[model samples]
Target: MGEAIIFKLHLVLGTTIFLLFPFTRLVHIFSGVAAPVKYILRRGYQIVRKRT
Candidate 1:
């Protein structure tokens, strides 16, 4: 009985993780582009501002 319960818990947890994994990738798909643009703009700003 204990083994069966453990097996069922493992199955449920595994399925939950597997199902959620791909949607998590949506974060990178949507937000990934803005980061590099911000980095480049900030670097350019520092270059101009440093002269003063």
Candidate 2:
């Protein structure tokens, strides 16, 4: 039936989007947070070395 075909198409589109998400900027918004974490880690290391 037409409804079944529409359902299958929706599933395919949703799956395709899910598979592509990691390569999209929508994912970058999450990964971008790591930059500050890296900076904080490096800053802490520097502080620890400077104190010793």
Candidate 3:
């Protein structure tokens, strides 16, 4: 195996993932995973910002 072959494999996998992002359960999975992190961070920010 060579570096060129590894790069091609990575490029192909990345392309496939990009293509699948909007048309499959991949969308749900990504957003489902990110939403709570945003919610949790925002909740903590509000609690800390208003301490007076």
Q: Number of backbone collisions per candidate, in order?
A: 0, 0, 0
- What tens-digit string does per-residue lDDT give for candidate 3 at 1-52? 4578889999999999898778863354456667756655653334456667
Query: Higher TM-score: candidate 2 or 3?
Result: 2
Clashes of 3: 0
- TM-score-best of 1 and 2: 2
The best candidate by TM-score is 2
Q: Least lDDT summed over 10 consecutive residues: which range in candidate 1?
A: 39-48
Q: Please provide, for model 2 over 1-52, each residue's C-alpha lDDT reduced to its tens digit, 9 standing for 90 to 100.
A: 2568889999999999999998864553555667656644553334344554
Minimum summed lDDT over a 10-residue window in model 2 is located at 43-52
Error of 3 at 12 (Å): 0.4
User: Which pairs of residues collide in candidate 1?
Assistant: none
Would you estimate the TM-scores of all the predictions? 0.41, 0.47, 0.44
Candidate 3 Cα deviation (angstroms), residue 43? 24
The C-alpha lDDT values of all candidates are 0.67, 0.69, 0.68
